[model samples]
Target: MTVVEADGSFVEPFVTKNLYINSGETYSVLVKADQNSSRNYWITTNAIKAHHDFVQAPPPISDRVIVLLNTQNLINGYPHWSGNNRSLSLPHTPYLIALKYNVTEAFDQNPPPDTNDIESYDIYDVSENKNAISSNSIYRIGFNTTVDFILQNANTVKPNHSETHTWHMHGQEFWILGYGSGKFDKVHDTKSYNLINPIMRNTVPLYPYGWTALRFRADNPGVWLFHCHIEFHFYMGMGIVFEAGLEKVGTLPTSIMGCGKTKDMIRP
Candidate 1:
């Protein structure tokens, strides 16, 4: 298949034998069936993505660059997924209204760590639970600031087991910089990023024991969720919230407010 577009945006045509598409992610590909007419042919599909098969460019230098690690761990004998040591739980309050009206008590503004301590924490260790912290914090980003995020996949609590994660962002579509296997080397991996024709995508996949690099601008105003598209994964706490320039979003109508703390706003 030859991919002509990705995530609703046109990209340099990418030809591949097997391609993986995640939820909220769209791709257009062309297939040529030139096989034997008398023989049966089957196209094989897998979870593997072509890492070095395209030429692309990321946005200009980001104001802030961060690397985050996601892991599936056992907490109190139950399974939960976390990003940067923080397991996310959806809050009842409307984060958009909270940020707009200075409702500090509505959500925690302490963001998750940018990166995990990979040196002390073994990426291959599954012997016991290592990270399990519950949080409903909203990561704040400056308006119009360019951001680069590197999502690193890690081992779960099961022996030799790691699952794939599909990360979907709200409010902004990002450029896929590159993909890498094994531990992500900041210095070496940064050198391998595609800065000529990077594909713009709202959702991207992360393979087990691998990493995916993405870049986007925080131009939107309001609260947006960045999470695994997998329903179960997100339900089990695999997501994070971002608040970007809420002041620029202006006041919210009663339609999207009054959930938790929007009652205090002066409404018409």
Candidate 2:
């Protein structure tokens, strides 16, 4: 995906690599459990986020939010599925976290502190209703030459007697920024991702009712699909496409990248 500036001009440095955080910047953090589960995930360090919790007084500044993998665990909930036989005492570490910063939370205008010591929530209180504090996994991909893209998943969901839902994206890979419930907070604006890297494929499991966030560049000019890959969920409209770079791709005859077959595009 290509990263463009506010005025439609392309940002070179940002589009060079999947740089998770911009250079010379740091964000304060706090940890909290998902809504019901005592399993604590990092919320915000200084302020309040709708679906996440924090251990420190997060500075009032706004930027892309990240989950602290060091502080997540499964302490208070029963095993999601007994047949699977993963340790009940173990917290199912998350692969990706859904982000809820843009259009949901309000952004702050101050620069953040360089170094901050944040506390974590009680491990014992981690509950099932809460966002699962993910012991996150990180993957690095190189775009082309100058920039590299980093990505991960942070949220998960286990509905009562339901199959685990894996959220995946098509044509573009994104960074698992953060996870939360309710509408996304409209604060943290979209982060610029470097696209001068290799292409990537990704999938993240979501906690039922939990939302995850992704950071990627809109460099690829295609109608990309972001949805639950459960197939059933997708047919039911759990899928939404991110339309980027459509203008440059000019309107080809409906025969190309269209929903209809050749016969449909042409009238008899």
Candidate closest to the true structure, highest lDDT: 1
Q: State each candidate's clash count.
A: 7, 73
Local accuracy by lDDT, each model: 0.82, 0.34
Candidate 2 lDDT tens digits, 1-268: 2344433443452333232344345433233333767555442333223422322221222233332111122324522211011111211211111111111111121222221121222212332344222111121222221211111212223223223456677767654545554323335422322223322346776553334544555456544555567775454334333335444454444333222122333465
Quote model 1's TM-score: 0.76
Tell me the tens digit of each residue's lDDT in model 1 across 50-156: 55655345666778877778888666668899888788987778777666667888877777777777656667767355658788986778898989888988788
TM-score against native, each model = 0.76, 0.32
Distance from true location, Cα of 14 in model 1, Å? 31
In model 1, the runs with Cα more than 4 Å from the true position are 1-57, 127-131, 263-268
